[model samples]
Target: MSLRTTLRVKTPPGFRVDASALLPVRLAAMSVAEIERIVLPAGNDRCIVGDVFEVSRGEATPALEAPHAGATLVIENAAPWLDRVGARMTDGHLVVHGSTGDYSGFQMAGGVLRIEGDAGHFTACEMRGGRLTVTGHCGDFAAGALVGDMEGMTGGTLTIHGNVGARLADRMRRGLVLVGGNAGEFAASRLVAGTIGIAGQLGAHYAYGMRRGTLLLTQRPAQLPPTFTGGGRGFDVFWALLVRSLAGEIAPFSQWHAASLPTRYAGDLAVDGRGEILVVS
Candidate 1:
């Protein structure tokens, strides 16, 4: 059996709550009483966990070894006022059962963070390593740089089952981002190095200033930027390998046939100009 800790919100807070400190690995070592006493930032005021949530401990069905030693934490009845849900988490499994505010999974370095509902802006900003899955749509700047930060999402895997807002993966350095629905403007803008796959419609200025990286799209845009030029044949081997690797990921990537090659365009020539955009027909 695995140790499972649950934090159920008793009432929605009038002010935003910073829940970054309530990580799975840290809470697993504490008793219920200890957890309840933990202080969390609420707007400008501080509140103890017990004051805002009902804490409980239970045994969860056993599963294969987890990334963080099988420790699990569940945030029940999560709301949009809950910010920084799993900031800087290094290990363990954390699940948010509802919507979350901005900066969810900010700079997380390891383990798995799953959001059952929508996530606000800057989700997974500057993330280093780990896996973050959002079942619903995400607001702007998901997996992108934080304000003046030079890099975003250095490593890890981010999967969004629904639509994504603007500036997706902006300044991203390294990682894999897969979106199941449409994306807003400036997707992959200034991307340094990474792989982003979108299965739906793209907004204007997509791949605006990409330097080095790969952007995979299932739907052709209304207009391909003039800076990008068609890439001639010769990537059949790479295409085969890429399709094979994505076979296990979300559709339509998983459904792609390795034998077929996608339409390739290379540019953002305005910059280092090495990035590629592959449109699956």
Candidate 2:
């Protein structure tokens, strides 16, 4: 049998809660009382986890780790103050059944985190590895650099099914970010490397200052910035391969594998100009 833990939010906090303490690694062996005694940040003071969450459990099972079977954490009626819900998790499964606050999966190295409702800012900041899915809209800086941080997501796959706010994937060095809806201003700005696929319209400065990376857009931008220029053909083979890869990731793009070539642009000449932006016809 698998062990499952559920944290039911009883009251919404007026201020934020640093929920990094709830990571699967930390909860692996804790008993009900111990889990409840965990400290959380509530505005200027500290509050016990018990004060806000009612804990419940399923059949007993082993701890959660990579490749290990069946351990789960579920947050029911999640509040916006619950930040960093699964930060730094190296393994296990987590589900937030409602809207979540900022830094939801900050720097997570591995595991799966699924948010069923809207996500606040910095949804997946500086993530190194893992799969994070947001079923609803996300605020600014999703999968982008944290304030003052040098880079954004370093590795992993972040899929958002709804609209994304500004600076999506900024300075991301590696990984894939897929947005099923529109992306805000400076999308993919200053990217060092990685792949970003957006199925809707882009805000201004779509690829501004981007140093490297591939951005796949299903729609055209209001205007292409001066830093970019056309990328001539000779990319047919690359296109074929990319479509095959993307087809498995986003169901809506399953037909992309047979679709015609998209218009390509290269540069952010202000930098290495090695990055590419492709817009589908």
Candidate 3:
């Protein structure tokens, strides 16, 4: 049989649900029916599965597992301000039909989060694992680190189809972020490791104080950090593999595989770093 859980909170004022705290652990080895029965917090009182949602049990179908396997969670029409629906989840698949609040996948370990609409700021802050794909635009710090923190995104992948706000990957340590449209200033500031690939132009000061990591651009950048030094020009097979791996998440980037080889630059010599920037020639 299949399992389904639908939220029933219609006009609950100021009632926010912290679904992230329950994920990965609660979703593992459980079916949809089992997921619906789990209790959800509502401010002061507790709510049961039948009280706040409508659940149906059936066999697993392609709709539920279209993106992947594991305990698939399909959230529909969650009102605005429902922040952190799936934070720190280690496994499972979470699908949201509408927009998501801030810190959608903060510190997530594994699993897949697909938001069909826009996402708020700090969308995937400090994400360690898993994959978060947003269809619409996002606010500032799309995949950045915590404020005043040195280490940014550690692991995982964040794919955005629409434009993103400022400081996309500031202080990123490890992981992969793919932006289909333009990005704001300081895109990869102080990036220690990992990669940030943008299919459009970077806003300004694209990479500043970047100690390590790779930033890929599809168009001619208006401005490049002075610290970065030109490394002549060369192609890397690893870039091809990265593009291939992200093809499904970012459809347009697939063309890079057949396009001309890009020019690579190494920089942040101010800190004696080894970060790199790759732009389409």
Indicate which candidate wins on TM-score.
1
Native-referenced Cα lDDT, model 3: 0.75
Higher-lDDT candidate of 1 and 2: 1
Candidate 3 structure quality by residue, lDDT tens digits, 1-281: 23333343444445665555445336545665676677766557555555555544434556655344446666666655667767887777777878877788888878888888988888889888888899998888877888788777899989999999899988888999999898998899878889888887677777888888888887767666778888754455676676677576665565666345678889888875688888865
lDDT by residue (tens digit), candidate 1, 64-106: 2255356889999999999999899998888889999999999
Regions more than 4 Å wrong, model 2? 59-70
| Ranking 2 against 3 by lDDT, winner | 2
Pairs with backbone N, CA or C atoms under 3 Å apart (clashes), candidate 2: none
Instruction: Tell me the tens digit of each residue's lDDT in model 2 across 1-281.
Output: 55678899997666788898886646757888999999997568778888889998775344332356356788899978788888888787888899989898999889889899999999899999999999999989888887788899999999999999999998899999999999999899999999999998888877889989999888787788898998767889888887887776764555575458889999989899999988876
Quantify all predictions' global Cα lDDT against the true fold.
0.92, 0.85, 0.75
Cα shift from native, residue 138, model 1 (Å): 0.2
Clash pairs, candidate 3, are 1-58, 1-59, 2-58, 2-59, 3-33, 8-52, 154-174
RMSD of each: 1.4, 2.6, 3.2
- Stretches > 4 Å off in candidate 1: 63-68
lDDT top scorer: 1
Candidate 2 residue 164 C-alpha distance from true site, Å: 0.6
Looking at candidate 3, what is the lDDT of residue 82?
65
> If scored against the real structure, what TM-score would every candidate get?
0.97, 0.92, 0.84
